[model samples]
Target: MLDDATKAKWYRIVFDLKKQFGKKPDMNGLIFLIGVRELGQMREFAKHEKMDLMHIATCKLLSYEGYYKFEHIDEEGWPHYSLVQKPPFTDLMSQENRLRKLIVDYYEDNGLFEDMDQA
Candidate 1:
């Protein structure tokens, strides 16, 4: 379960990302944006490309918490991360909470949520 601080942080992240994008972005959408930012390309993502982008974002988020490890960026600039630890939560809701906590960690660790905290 996510702690109160994590839930609050997640709420702020959603608000901030929505403000940045000018619309409400769901978990997948926010992760896709993070993936595109990581990929260093903001261009339109095709349907197939979006899947890969979401995967990249998942890896990126997991890497921070030791569930994955960054390996290398491919020639096309796609990131590759090797699984380092099995995820503890397996159920859908638990998995979602874990991701939410990790996403909050992502924003906090990267200073992305600093602005949110100030306001």
Candidate 2:
């Protein structure tokens, strides 16, 4: 479990990233920001969230918008995302991103994502 300080740090990071980038962030971006170094781990997280499609589509949209560049790093064809300029929050989108990440994490920890996957 994450301690209070760690959670606060995550909140601040998400807040900053959102301030720099306008669009809502997806799972990959959040994972990347939290210092996840492996694309497979991120893919697992996506699989857990049932957000694989949403995450992939969001990455494509962000790439087209010139916010970042994405590369495929998985043998199963999952894309590894790298940011170009990072995100700019400065608005409600930042909070939204934070909320999204939190929700995803909650679902993951509660096995909701895992249960859905097995169903």
Candidate 3:
């Protein structure tokens, strides 16, 4: 289970995202948004591309922890990464918590939070 602080940060993230985008985003949606931001392009992605975006988001998020390192961006503007180390977490809950914390970190790093006093 998420600790109280993590839960509060997660709630602020979702709330701010909804307030900005005019829709609530679940975990997958947040991942997708991160993928879009990383891609630096806003366009309709095909179903397969959507999956690829999520993969990119995963790699990018893990990269923050030094699990993955950015390799290069392809001619098509797709970023690639190499796995440096596998994630330390084994169980689903732990992995989710890690990702949640990473998401919060991402927002802070990007200065996306408007009123982070609550966070």
Against the reference, the lDDT scores of all candidates come to 0.84, 0.53, 0.88
**TM-score of each model, paired residue for residue:** 0.85, 0.34, 0.85
Q: CA lDDT of 18 in candidate 1?
A: 78
**Model 1: CA > 4 A from native:** 115-119
* lDDT per residue as tens, model 2, 27-66: 5665454333222345445544445545554554455446
Error of 2 at 46 (Å): 8.0
- Candidate order by lDDT, highest to lowest? 3, 1, 2
TM-score of 3: 0.85
Q: Rank the candidates by TM-score, best first.
A: 1, 3, 2
lDDT against true structure, model 1: 0.84
Q: What TM-score would you give candidate 1 relative to the actual structure?
A: 0.85
- In Å, residue 13's CA in model 2 sits off its true spot by 33
Q: State the lDDT at 8 in candidate 1.
A: 83
After aligning candidate 1 to the native by TM-score, how far in Å is the CA of 15 from where it should be? Answer: 1.5
